[model samples]
Target: MAERTSFSNEEYADILFYYGAARGNAEQARREYGEIFPNRRLPDARVFSRTFRRMRERGTVVRYQGDAGRPRLEVGDDEEEILNHFQIDPTLSTRMIARRMGRSQWKVWYTLHENDLHPYHYTPVQAIEEGDPFRRMQFCRFLLNADVEDRNYLKRILWTDESKFDKDGITNYHNAHYWSVRVMGNPHLKRQKGSQRRFNLNVWMGIIHNRLIGPHFLPQNLNGVEYESFLRNVFHELMEDMPLETRQNMIFMHDGCPAHFRLAVRSWLDQHFPDRWIGRGGPIPWPARSPDITPMDFFVWGRMKSLVYATDVPVPNIEDLRNRIINAAQEIQSELTDSRVVKTGVVRRARACNRNNGGHFENEL
Candidate 1:
């Protein structure tokens, strides 16, 4: 007897009926089939059993057509439905939308891409208060006016800020990874914990006209008194290397932190820098929560941290971390001296801020 590869719907129904009538016995069903269709060749006994089992399991002996060929890319209603899901909730992930709509994730993703949709990562920005925009606009205009007076005004201002560095340096897991053929254990980063006591160093740095001054270490908990002493003693000494004329003409800038706004600190700025300083209650009021405009905040610290923590090895101790920070600062200083990129960015940011009416402008830049 010949083995059959295909069966019509009527032929399938007859095979299932005969198998059922024979009390689920494949040999009896085959015999019955041969008797009923005397002219037709008998299908293999295994075919009868398989047909019977398929009917019992799926309520039909129809072969599955799902994997017959590659599925055509869906258009019309499917495309409209996928687009509608995104239009309703733009925050929905492709996987989530796929599950909700009973579609494959790749299909949904392809549809989005076909429509020129892209996923944009969210950027964290400082909160702007009710009166912040007005103040920001005012301050940005002040910078612009100063620039008009001197083309090199932005470069002549010393940008300063303090940042903390510790054994557990920043690690962007998104960009850090190891590729392999097989699944492996997650890589661990060692860090100091409680009882072992993690150590942190508060570092202050200044950038002015392609020159970087002191990677000065401040007390862990900086207060008004410590900040005042830093200005009175440490800051002036750091300026010794600058040309006398440049030092006289330079403008000092710091943020509106409580330590920076102290009476003694403001008084020192008034005496030393006179009207050539920008900060809280100084000659120029640096807007609160406005790190977006400062070169130290917007550029230097981020760049230095990336360089300091570029290695996979964890910093062994406070001393090691300090050395890494000093080295990173030196590298940044060399880059600064070679180009006017950072200084030029200050003027560009000032214009952008003014155009935005003092709102967040980093995104626009």
Candidate 2:
């Protein structure tokens, strides 16, 4: 576009020349174009000095109040508070401090961003559980423990949990990738109707040195007889058949389920090499809903679900879904165990289970 010059448009001339020239520069963009800028604080004194000197003959830009205008940046009191908090503690990232303050990470980011605190090195990367401080601490603890423990611990310690999967359904957004998309709006998604053959699928999963060990799914309607049998079957498949050395070293740690806590189950556990089975953490006993202390609650399950949801496979049946889930779990372990993954320090915050007890989640609370 050609430059147009007239007394009426003379003031607007700097609008084009200034912005066009400032496609990139050390000088900051002015908050306003004309002499209308109150107080006339130069966006960049150096830029104004250079610009005015160059346009001395052309009269393209006039030196208004001997300075250029400040850009559209506005820093409120809240923004200043965040800036001060960040400046004092260089260790706390935008998301971390945001978590502490019970606020969105982007809110903190915006605070810094408006104050021109955004930079190359201090660039904000998207973090998970960005709003919860306790979870962040939990994630940090998991990393710390993993870093200290040997690879053998992760393997020997079998992490087991019961995941109920519908015959052909999607529970959350994560379950969609593992369900049958063939039927538009899958009807099997709801709870199985009366007298229906609802698959009471129960899986026992374990990991060994970044390798998934077992996931022996229990039979349908597994009662005491079936659960006991399933346990014995799992033992036969993993522990009973393995060499004495392998069975001796392999430690199984499972979540507290009603069936798992049954006296018969405890009897079975005691009978199977007595002290070998995981205890309820000594005499005091581990409390229910303490997911904050568990490794699986934060890292493993969430990562697996994330991967499962991301998968775009045509899950035809439960068999296919199981296979897909296993694959997702494997992928999570593979990605999580990699040296690069751990080094990245992607903390998966500790979660508070009791959200109803006056709801204490954020550090601020």
Candidate 3:
């Protein structure tokens, strides 16, 4: 195990004085502090600077009560009230909770842990409204009972969706954290919202078993006519690639977008897929706002987004963004699809949704 790295309150006091006396020269402060406390090695400049800055900001060199000064596990009506507040709304911040409960933030946090309560980050999900639970349950039950040729129905599913990728869409700094002696600041360049350089580009794609198809970038906004054209001009090619028997058994899956419900698109789907499809006006009513069950929404899009923006190389134009998306889609391997989509994950998700009585589940699609 590593040595205890946290400094004592006495050491913090000495460091604070030296940091000020040395006028923020971290190295000079460290050397001066070492002269006073010969037995203890001074922390690195980064740690020293962070601690010093924190002390100044908090207006104290002494540690917070629950974290460093003392471990306060004592509970009363106050602690119980804090826990109850959190139980009612888990999203309540400790600071906000402290303000409401007239208690220290640290004490409230400690009490929460004492009661085996911890704050979990909120997950982004499609908002489920009234009657969605029944729809979600029905969808899960269909998947659970679905069978084709004595095999699971998922084997024949062509899960498809459209996603928008922005040229300047950068990951959130809050979502990206550094685990070290001190928290590091984000260094990635920031882009302003609604800037011309930050324009969004849309792509349509489908996933079937171990195969990924068509990250076709839309040159214009997708409407009923464009969606119909895509189905005729692009989606047919997807069908042509598969064996005749596979095509016969396959079930097309898409969300209930306005374009998907348009008469022309519905006519085409009716003529081509007949009863073998999942969506509005088909055999199964795909649950509204439940992307957690779709491979494209939860897994494929996230994996591609992470890959597309991962590099430090600048995407100067829409073409560059398109190329990056295509490359990322190509990099999605068979084994990855086998593990994420073809395995028991999709079925397990349906079961989880069913268990929750059609309520929104934890993990994303």
Which candidate ranks first by lDDT, i.e. highest? 1
**lDDT of each model, Cα atoms only?**
0.77, 0.47, 0.71
Poorest lDDT segment (10 consecutive residues) of candidate 1: 178-187
- By TM-score, the candidates rank as 1, 3, 2
Q: Between 1 and 3, whose TM-score is larger?
A: 1
Return the lDDT, model 3, position 37.
79
TM-score to true structure, per model: 0.65, 0.41, 0.63
The parts of candidate 2 lying over 4 Å away from their true place are 1-155, 166-201, 220-222, 239-243, 279-284, 312-314, 329-365
* lDDT by residue (tens digit), candidate 2, 61-111: 432222345433233356657766765754456667688777777777766
lDDT of 1 by residue, 292-322 (tens): 7888877888899899899878889888899
When 1 and 3 are scored with lDDT, the better candidate is: 1
**Candidate 3 residue-wise lDDT, 1-365, digit = tens:** 11222677777777778877888777688888888778897665555665676666777544343555545555556865875676575556778878877878888767765443434334444667899999999988888777423455787898999888886655564532211121222222222222112347878888877778788776446788989998899877866777888788888999888778888988888888888888877767788778778888667888888889997666789878888888898888544645546436678888889988998665433
What candidate 1 gets wrong by more than 4 Å, as runs, is 1-117, 171-199
lDDT of 2 at 26: 22
Would you give me the overall lDDT of model 1? 0.77
The predicted structure with the larger TM-score, 1 or 2, is: 1
